[model samples]
Target: MHRQSVAARARQALQSKPRASQHRKTRGRVALSNNHRAFRHELHYITRGGGRPVILVHGIAASHSEWGHLIPDLAACGYHVYAPDLPGHGNSPKPGDAQYYQVESLLVQLETWIESLNLQEPPLLIGHSLGGYLGLAYARDHSGEVRGLVLINPLYSPRQLSPVLNLMRKRPQLGEKALRATPKWVIQALVHLDPSAATQFSPQIRQQIAADYKRASPNIVYLTQSLPDMTASLPLVKAPTLVIWGEKDLSLNPASFPELVKLLPNAAGCPIAGCGHQPHLCKHQEVNRLVLEFMNSAAVAR
Candidate 1:
């Protein structure tokens, strides 16, 4: 009953072109409480479009701008979008304490954010990389609050993580020291050296990622310390899911998609041919079309 009502409301919203939200990007802050140490933190978000809500979560070292191309597209299709910079990334606060980086703590803070939005109906959650991990966790823990999930090259295993991140997860102090010691150019070289990123990312996309990443919190690596636990929570996610991946995503194991599909109770997936980590930007039209079709089919199913 509730699902159908929400759909009807969405349909009603589509009757008019949502002019106010069209192409206009609004950045703002909201006070959200983190479960870790009961700390209150301010979350920064970018919102665009209006209508049935769609939440976009970017990976570590990235922000809401990661969806620059997709945001306007979704808005034009009559879906309101909210893209947030998870703590320690983008414009959101970076806490000095390590506990705030725990996977559970991040998930709780995200849940609080959704609740505060008073979305009236569940919002579709879409995330990339660590963002995908957060979206998956949100769907798993608060199944009743999400309309569906779209995980793009999501983080699943510690093995899929970068060497520096993996090292950080193992030896916190050494990892911190290494992260601090690594030169900016060396870090870029390590990432770009990966064939996935080296061959695929357009110069424009690469530049954008580089600029956004430079501002990312140094302690951001700690966010993945609880990877195994989050990976274990996968089977518990009840929302219908669409797993999108880039076939050449060395950033996160490309082969992990099939395994992810198997673990999800109600899920489907697609791999973008010749694409790399940033499939949405790498192949915006195809990715956008897939998302539209998936949402349409999901609505019909509901």
Candidate 2:
């Protein structure tokens, strides 16, 4: 009888070993699913890391590749980052229809992308320029869906345009034709007009920018048209917000920074000295530090 009892104990231990192994395998699969899945939407995005999630949005005429330098840094700092190439830019499909360029339509695509990912928690939304404006609109509509927001050199109004752009706006048809007909060199020249923006690009990045410009010219009209709606939605955003601007930013008016902070109920602003429109590219180290700090503080507060 003692021999039989010992045999039974050994059988039980063998069964339990497999159960323990199975549990570990299941845990690993869960982690893999979170960190390695292709998110389908109008945009093509890259996902990395495996911690609290953060969505990075690029500005007008920019793609997910624009965040190339910043993605690895954020991922290493313990955040899962999703950087999407907005429709009509990067590898994403560019539909000629004006409807897809509307702020509301872009918001819909973003909401769908987030839901499809099935994130474990609400994500931090970060945007630059045109993207910043879209992030504000998203936070306003889905207040409970976002933990926090970071807007880098956000475009608040059409009045913020440079003199060259203002002149272009006066002859919309001619401007549109010229943009669509311009050679790639002209597009590159126009894009690099801002010294701060130009200095940030490597040769590879410059090629990508040139290609994006060719495809994105048609979408520019829609971008300007959506400005009024974006401005209208600013006061409604309820998320803890951090607005970072480049002091030397020529893309958007520095004077509007104070007005932007005042428009949001729970928002703060920071200006990076000697930086321009593309802070994440031009002043990545400082931008990353501030972003991490703001996100951590906001997480703790909640």
TM-score of each: 0.82, 0.78
- The candidate maximizing lDDT is 1
What residue pairs clash in candidate 1, if any at all? none
Q: All candidates' lDDT scores?
A: 0.74, 0.70
- Which residue runs does candidate 2 get wrong by more than 4 Å? 1-41, 166-172, 197-201, 229-233, 298-302
lDDT minimum window of 10 residues, candidate 2: 27-36
User: Model 1, 51-121: lDDT tens per residue?
Assistant: 88999999877889889888998899888899888888788888776656666566656766766676757
